[model samples]
Target: MANDTGKTTIDLGNLKAGGFIKERGKDLFTVRLRVPGGRMTVPRLKKIADVAEKFGGEFVHLSVRQSIELININFKDFDAVVAELGEGEQKVASCGARVRVPTACGGCEYNPNGLVDTQRSALEVDEKLFGTPTGHHKFKVGFAGCPFDCPKSATNDVGFQGAIWPELNKDECISCGLCAKSCAEGAITLGADGKPEFHPDACIYCGDCVKVCPTEAWKAAKKGYTVRIGGKWGRHPLVGTLFATFLPEDRVVDFITEVLAWYKEKADGAGRIRIGDIIIKEGTESLLDRLRAGFPDFVVAETIPPQAIATQVGK
Candidate 1:
């Protein structure tokens, strides 16, 4: 039924899904623009500024998920705003219970600490999976170039952090101890024989040793992403647990597809349950079993419980 304003409830819901968020004002909305991987050209950014000045408020809101929200837009100007944005090849971001735009940090292209091409990965995921229906709730994905985790990968539903497992070639070792000196995790230490001793348990896989080894003695044994599943931040935050190590970059999309399949099946008939909650209810082993069928090599055999933060306020 149409409200007194002559718009049905469905109209507002559809607008929300299309990135036109209703504001407290009677007819004002916020128009969110899709900027995948948080990267945009100067010309495109200039276009957004022009659009904001013409159709929106004095300021635009930069969303935490790396989208740009043009504020104080009138519902009547939605079409005009979208058209103007399209002139610059920009598009609207999605909201509601769907896969939102992927967020990422500067990857190996520019960032010195980056171990993988996170920007490329984020763009790929955005192109293939952005705005997919999650059925139960919103799904988030993040890509961190390295363990520095500028994008806070562990706070998303599906998170990927670049990793590198290093190996020492004793034949090339100059015994200069640079590898041990560069290891922040202390995973590498010089033994009595002046050779580097590796403690795998202590390694966070940042590749510092490999980079610092002047003689190329330390090298990457494996380089890929460390996948974490079912993480989220909200009223009740859960830090995602490690699901796979050294997951090949080429297989990320397929891996996510399988994860979504499992989520859809398990979350069926369960109202508004996040992936982490399903894991908590059905147990991590259940999901592991499903993943192992397709990804026996990358999937870890064991996983730790997602850390739950106590967020009860005034209880």
Candidate 2:
């Protein structure tokens, strides 16, 4: 129903229950539980299975936001289910105009290609931003361990990708060429002198060269987060624009808070409003100016579209 400002209000009880309103069921609801970073301990897993078997219809559905949903829970069993989940210390995930559970790929924890601790970042974001109010629409955040963007961070409201800029030491180079071979972006190539040459503009800073360098010729010059803002996926998907890079992990929380504050300040509506729209309407440079003003340490990426062709040479 609409509230005082004509904004639609979601039910507080349903939100707390992580309840999904069912259209065709004996009970009106199904519950969703948050599992940040999409990873859970064995004990918690077992507890969830047992709880589902006891109260739900013994079926669990996994959500895109890294949450687990127990279906076929009757209204009468709601209290019991909530108590069981509480006892297990599992938080319920809500779906509305708030920060949802963050999603992340397996970062440096185990993935060979990982450049940063994505799981740890996810947990940190969850602790700091989960369920925080957004002014007009829902906000989603995702973290990718590297440029692979496995978690589809490109399509989230706030996307953080792990990166490392590598520096080469010509003296230490054995010139094995492994770094060139490992680089998928063609950012690194062995020159005639048998030393690796780097193309900074083409490099996504995935850190492959650093990992593959046998002589430690390619060293990590800068390791940090690349921020992408104003992206979302749905009927009309808009890929987020790259906002900043080389953002130290320690400063990510502050960056996110400022971005959210800016969004809330600019967005005004009862219906869904996205940061991408704000960027488009006000010009990306406007947002960039504010970001630069607030966080002077960050290096914002310059986005320039390809120049137009003079003529269609081939049809």
Candidate of highest TM-score: 1
Residue range with the least summed lDDT across 10 consecutive positions in model 2: 304-313
Off by over 4 Å in 2: 1-23, 304-315
lDDT of 1: 0.89
**lDDT (0-100) at residue 293 of candidate 1?**
93
Checking candidate 2 for backbone clashes, the offending pairs are none
Q: Which candidate leads in lDDT?
A: 1
**How much RMSD separates candidate 1 from the native structure?**
3.3
Q: Write the per-residue lDDT of candidate 1 for residues 133-243, one digit (tens) a residue.
A: 989998889999889899999988899999999998899999999888988888999999999999999999899898888999999999999999989998899999999
| Model 1 quality (TM-score) | 0.93
> Residue by residue across 133-236, what tens digits does model 2's lDDT show?
78678888888999988998878888899999999999999988999999999999889998889999899999989998889989998988888887887655
Model 1 clash pairs are: none
lDDT of 2 at 70: 86
Off by over 4 Å in 1: 1-17, 313-315
